[model samples]
Target: MGSLMHLIPVTDPADPRLAAYTSIREKDLTSGHGGRFIVEGKVTLETLLTRSRFAVESLFLAESRLAPLADLLAKVPADVPVYTAPQDIMDQVAGFPMHRGVLACGLKGDIPLPGEFISEDKPRSGPLLLLSDISNHDNTGACFRNAAAFGAGGLLLDERCCDPLYRKAIRVSSGASLFLPYAHGGTGLDMVNAVLNAGYTVWAMTPRAEAQPMQSLPVPDKLAILLGAEGPGLPDALIAAAEPVRIPMSAGFDSINVATAGAIALAHVFGEKQG
Candidate 1:
């Protein structure tokens, strides 16, 4: 099942052949349909090829970087094209300093149906984690870290959330973002209802004075924690539908990082031992 090698030496940075991945700049790839995703470096690209559900259209690498990734390339089906571009040309095409020396273009991974990502087939003794409007890849990535670390069943986000497979998020999660399942789409209300219908209590995280303290709450057998963006916090609509819970803070201290709060809340929800 080894991929066929095109071995074309690309010199011109503007080569039309690079069009498939040239516009894969961070901003353009963040959220869209028909937007392609590029996996850079040999390790990550290979990992995505093997682990993700996305279609792999092409993989490009520098001639020098090929030997080390040969085994990985061999895993790809023979029909898939593996292109070789000069290292300098690749650096130019990427518009970034080249370190790993290889990159690829593939169809983006589509978010699965919310139900499939958090279904009963999902191993869950407790509720899930719902991420809404927290588009910062780092925060979204950290939330995923906390979700898996504390044994939350799945990671759920709204349509507007950052791409989980975005470069920064993937780097921050150190590849764990791909290990667990996540879903997107629907308004935050729809996400809450989905979890509630699945018999999980939904607690939306917020720092409002009216919110119940996280430390004092009795967590349900299944729980979903709704986290908002950094400064703005959760929307009022989501707050209205979900139980608003706060991680207690000293009077002077205002709020915690959404990701940090996620970890603490997940720990409490799973009844996991704390540091």
Candidate 2:
């Protein structure tokens, strides 16, 4: 079904109505500074539309690209303005090539704390991803995608983690961040305590010798997989607090990219439960 939105034609790149779409990369959107964030590409936009919590403030698309998105556009509400501009004008407003030709500005809701994010009902069932100081947007986004792909219940982030709603991160996540339930709150240990209280078995990933190998680690009924920033891994104290586990590899190569490692861990935990 096609939506009956108000299709507003945009001729000038500097129009005031287009403020949210202007210089997206240079401005702050993730902190809810402007109460809005940019979402690009068809996949991300589609995901946002389906997820009810995220409200679409407006949409911008290259004139030539509108026809292809007719069905999806029809799903948008009539009150929302769908702005169409020439490909060149979009590039001017974005200050970069808008190759995908489709973009959207979505309003972000208030962020909940870690304790509020974890559900009390059936808390000891699915996997949960607990991220610590994962500063890089790409890695953070990738983890969200992984969490969604593997059916992890939700995500909890420490204070040092980057906003997953950042434009590049959302793009990298292919829109998974927009749909995945996540909250940023407290310190690393605080998040751990919240998950443990919610009935999850906390497992921290590390490359240390004392850590159990992934092959030997049992998949708990309700698991919280802890991951940290790439180079430093988890804090020594945090590792000691949780059951530390390592993905077995050749002796000379003990580490992997944090995103890759997260996917592997999620796969093991989920695969084991299913088996």
Candidate 3:
């Protein structure tokens, strides 16, 4: 059980509880833990707490790092433990500068399958973003933030994409990933098949000349923006299978960031903003 008073004080860096916390900048590139993701700082943690999908087991906060939050510590479930450490150790554990002064460890919960998220009644005709294989956390997170801000319905991620619940993605998402309805860790091919089968146009957002531009694209009433990675873009196999579509842009500029493209697409698709 967690107690603000009993918060275990760790003076040594060898503590096992702190091992999961990694630097935000380098973790996605080199963290050895397989199939594991991290969520750093306070806002991201708070967002995760609100969403019921993931189970947050513990939190590690630097005693000196008191600048990160409000007085909501007491509001967490009494059973969830909160640990405190020195600023230096917290910095080391985070693997980056610890401006926010708090870190948390959580297990990823089961997410909806591709088909389920598309028809997900939670958003009710909301714009959806489908990711092909965007490995970068920044893009994934940014895409989520835009989806939430613009009232997009939900988010769909294929197997190749980075975990949205991961610390880096969560932080970049400003915790929007949690607020947004997303079904993670599905296969691109399966997601494409399901979206197509469900009467969605599966507008593949790319710059291929033959692809229909966003201006002319028939983004359905219930839409899913098929986005790819930063440089690699969508795999040819996936694009070939999906309904070819693109977002219109200046001739020289091939595209915008996946997240930006998503926001633009959402505005166009849900232009009327019904209820």
Question: Per model, how many backbone clashes are there?
Answer: 4, 2, 8
Judge candidate 2 against the unseen true structure and give its global Cα lDDT, from 0 to 1: 0.86
Maximum-lDDT candidate: 2
**Among these predicted structures, which one has the highest TM-score?**
2
TM-scores across all candidates?
Answer: 0.84, 0.95, 0.84
Ranking by lDDT: 2, 1, 3
lDDT of each candidate versus the true structure? 0.74, 0.86, 0.73
Q: Write down the lDDT that model 3 would get.
A: 0.73
Tens digits of per-residue lDDT, candidate 1, 1-275, equal 24535556677889887776564553556356675666666556766767766677777788787778777777876666777777777777777766777777667656675665666474654457788888787888788778867887778887768877776676576555666677877777777778878777788888899999888887676778888888888889889988888888898887889899888888886774332
Best of the two (1, 3) by lDDT: 1
Q: What does candidate 2's lDDT look like per residue over 48-114, in tens digits?
A: 8887368899999999888899888878877788899999999999989999999998988787778
Q: Which segments of model 2 are wrong by more than 4 Å?
A: 1-5, 119-125
Q: Give residue 118's error in model 3 in angstroms.
A: 4.7
Clash pairs detected, candidate 2: 2-74, 3-74
**Which candidate model has the greater TM-score, 1 or 3?**
3
